[model samples]
Target: MTADSSLLAQAREWHVLLHSGRATAADRAAASAWRCTSPAHEQAAMDVERLWALLGQLGEQPASEPAAAQVRPLRRRRSLRWAVPLASAALLVLALWLPQGAWMSWNADFATAPGEIRSVELEDGSILTLNGATALDWTISEGRREIRLYRGEADFQVAKDSTRPFFVEAGPARIRVTGTRFDVDYDGQDVVLAVTQGQVQASDAQAQPLLVGASQQVRWSGERLQPLQALDARQQLAWQRGKLVFRAQPLSEVFTELERSQRQRVIFLDQSVRDLKVTGVFAHDDPQAVLRAIESNLPVRLVRLPGLLLVSRS
Candidate 1:
């Protein structure tokens, strides 16, 4: 590991020890030495502090469980001495996994990092949950609540608006609602909609109206409105609830969903993997864990590039 990476590892281990309640006298001494090592040490600790701030914002329990700090019992055994270094190396890599996107709440806008869950309350007391890698422009003015989801998915629990309906515009389609909960997902070609609480009337800027009821979904593939069957409330809105449920979904599509929650971008290395069917219920964060689950269920191999994630047939 580089110097920066090494310091980060130490900083993460220190915090883990502090939180785990297993921090011994030796762990405290090591932290003291690390803090005074150099300015880089301070910087790494500050980085960890920043991460914790964003991580604790949405809820007390983080969706991604942090790595534990290394605390080897001071046994006089020599075999475990080698194990200590191995443990440190593993924890160091875990620190680098922290994504910067989770800090979006600290900004004027609201966003989630890869493997983060973000919840924001609007001016009208409604709640909005933004999935990882999702981007949306939200501005409430005069008598209108408008949001433009540029990409990814967002679930909105809209406050009441009679004259000025709560509106979400994704691509060419716009959904108009008044005091309800709904989800909007904008992919490249198709704009998807799912209503959770109240009724939603969706219409393209240049197309006919598509009415969707609670517990229902409708998709517009740029040409016509396709009404989908009624389904469970979790089918489309599960991500906000920290669950990802797939039913015979292709690996390519699963990778797209996983990209939102992973620090590393997962790219399919072969066309066969793209068409491979996958089904599971994975938590919204710690997407790497989801990949391990996939590997256990399917015939695949995962390769780590310098800054990318590649998946292929075994």
Candidate 2:
């Protein structure tokens, strides 16, 4: 396994141990030492801890349940060492196997690496521009042309094919358009649609026939589609022109976009600093240089570690 993946595995182990309420002082000390070895390790541990907390919230028991009149002690209690690993395995499956999109991209017909932009002509002469780290598969059948966006984002300039309707699928949401220009992004949880020209129909498992027109955007989850919101469609498509524009966006969001464009991992240590608003346009050419520009404007310090970048308050 790569060094980053190895560290993540180790961190998950620590998560199960420490959160099981069975860790000794020595074990806690060891975990601290491991985190100090690298920021990547710390970040992985943080992710596991966050997930564990969320699971606890979801598994909360009812407060009004009556106590059993006759209580029988179990012959033996199962060790959490085994139990927590099972739960962690489920979490891993959800991260890799579900709609997060990494696994699906392996079979994509067209893809673009991080920081690389490419445009291709479809069989029907439509132009598709894939953003960095994006993957998709397309098929043109007799009556319909379909594209599945597994990860990242894409801009479509559909050809005038009145006979074959075009459709783009991102997770549980679908976008249907005969001939239009628009953008779609699947960011793990939500499929975001932005229309630049003409009108398109967006639908999900729960909602159908939602219309999106020029200069409007909407977010769709599996069960619900958000109301259309007004936005500058051109500004949202700035990535296609090799630039990233942020308007009062959080530092965490900026870091996420930066990581994707640079194909590098970024670890933010201070949660309090994550929500600071940032606004600017930065080139996607060199991620390190882009970060330096951010540091100059924002009150944050970045530490470059092997295979990862650490963000902390200045």
Question: What Cα-based lDDT does every candidate model obtain?
Answer: 0.70, 0.74
Over 244-307, each residue of candidate 2 has an lDDT whose tens digit, in order, gives: 8888988887877775676455656556789988887777676666687678888888765323
Query: In model 1, what are the clashing residue pairs, if there are any?
Result: 102-113, 115-261
Supply the global lDDT for candidate 1.
0.70
What would the TM-scores of all predictions be?
Answer: 0.64, 0.65
In the range 89-117, model 1's lDDT, one tens digit per residue, is 34333434543233334443556556666
With a 3 Å backbone cut-off (N, CA, C), the pairs that clash in candidate 2 are none
Query: Which regions of candidate 2 are displaced past 4 Å?
Result: 1-105, 221-223
Among all windows of ten consecutive residues in candidate 2, which has the lowest summed lDDT? 69-78
